[model samples]
Target: MLSTVSPRVADPNVRTALVETAARLLAEQEGLTIRRLAHEVGTSTMAVYTHFGSMEDLRRAVRLEGFARLAAHLDAVERSRDPVADLSALGWAYCFNALANPNLYRVMFLEAPIDAEEAESGGATFAPVVAAVQRCIDAGRFTSCDAWSLAVQTWTMVHGMVGVVLAGVFGPDEMLGHLSTMTVSLYVGNGDSRAAAVRSLARARRRMEPHAPIKRSDGAAEFERPRIQNAAP
Candidate 1:
């Protein structure tokens, strides 16, 4: 008797589910096996092979998805009159994506060795940051520095800060504030634009945050909103 193949085997929805589940499992338990993933996804091990040629391929897909989502998040950030604010928005969006998908984030940034495909994915993810830096340079907020160098430096800084947060050394509340401030200061200070940097940071923070308080139907502020709860180290 021929076994019926699930039409979803190669569907994008199933592929996404498998990739997302794989990332979460890999993040929760480093060194996740294909067999385990199949068991968790409630499909035959063949499903893994069908969707992704192998576990390494699955991991690659997971990493690629992470970068894809990051690119979209950064893309949605409105490019406004404030170049510094625009750049800062990209910076924090990086962190927001990390917190939302720590397991996938780790896999994308740290878990595995990078192959040619992974390199391409990584480059695509950082292109927005480079563009944002260029905007700052054009606005005279970053002096004569090349956009690539500044982009790489700022990314390295944010990457290191996120690593520290993921390593349990720094809580998000404590470290994110310090890291973000330092990044803005470093960029603006390098251009002799300290005062402008201060204003940029203030404006960026205001723009990212909700000015009006979140109120319940009775009008009391929803003080219970736990901002930054995941501490997956």
Candidate 2:
């Protein structure tokens, strides 16, 4: 039997516009209404319902969009013989994604409620990080352990720091140095020597610096979030 498709298929351009607008509204702490959202995107109010079913569904879509973009960034990090450096690069990618898409990042983790399948999709996005952790174990940079568990621990450490910076506890300029220190410490705690961890992270940072965001003297970010295409859940 052929799979059934929904009769009300959404235009990808409109979907992208709606999701991006919603994320930005959330970041700016503005109220979201179907009418306002539709007006912002030059569409009818019914278009919101036609595309997303309801506002709650739109929230879920926005979260999934965030994960999709994160997955893309993580997948772009090149692998190398040095597993520790590769792992560090993955961490940097995660950080960059969060920084680049603050509104979507907040929606992904903080604002919205995700259903069971959506939750699974979010986990799938983290697979690259887990794979990097497994590489470290395979190379004996980390002790034999559950790579998923180790990845979770390392991920949460970075996430907490990101949250702090996002909340303005620290400026963006200060985040990289603190992140470097924390990342090296986590690697050392896992089994790598401190010196080796530092060297590995340095390698990754050097590779990342060319593309990293530059902050203006007034604290505005030179890097803005890219418009991401929505992935099917």
Q: Largest TM-score belongs to which candidate?
A: 2
TM-score of each: 0.82, 0.85
Clashing pairs in 1: none
Instruction: In angstroms, give how far residue 56 of model 1 lies from its true place.
Output: 2.6
Candidate 2 at residue 9, lDDT?
Answer: 66
CA deviation > 4 Å runs, candidate 2 = 1-9, 215-233
Q: Relative to the true structure, how large is the alpha-carbon lDDT of every model?
A: 0.74, 0.80
- Candidate 1: Cα lDDT at 160: 87
**Candidate 2 residue pairs that clash:** none
Which TM-score value belongs to model 2?
Answer: 0.85
Can you write out model 1's per-residue Cα lDDT over 129-182, one digit (the tens) per residue? 899898888877888689999898889888888889778888766565677568
Model 2 lDDT-worst window of ten: 224-233
Candidate 2 positional error at 200, Å: 0.8
lDDT of 2 by residue, 1-233 (tens): 99989787678999999998999887777998889899999998878888898888888888889999888888889998888888888877888888877889998888857789779988887888899999999889999467998999879987887899889997555777777777877888889998888788878876666555555687544554332222100
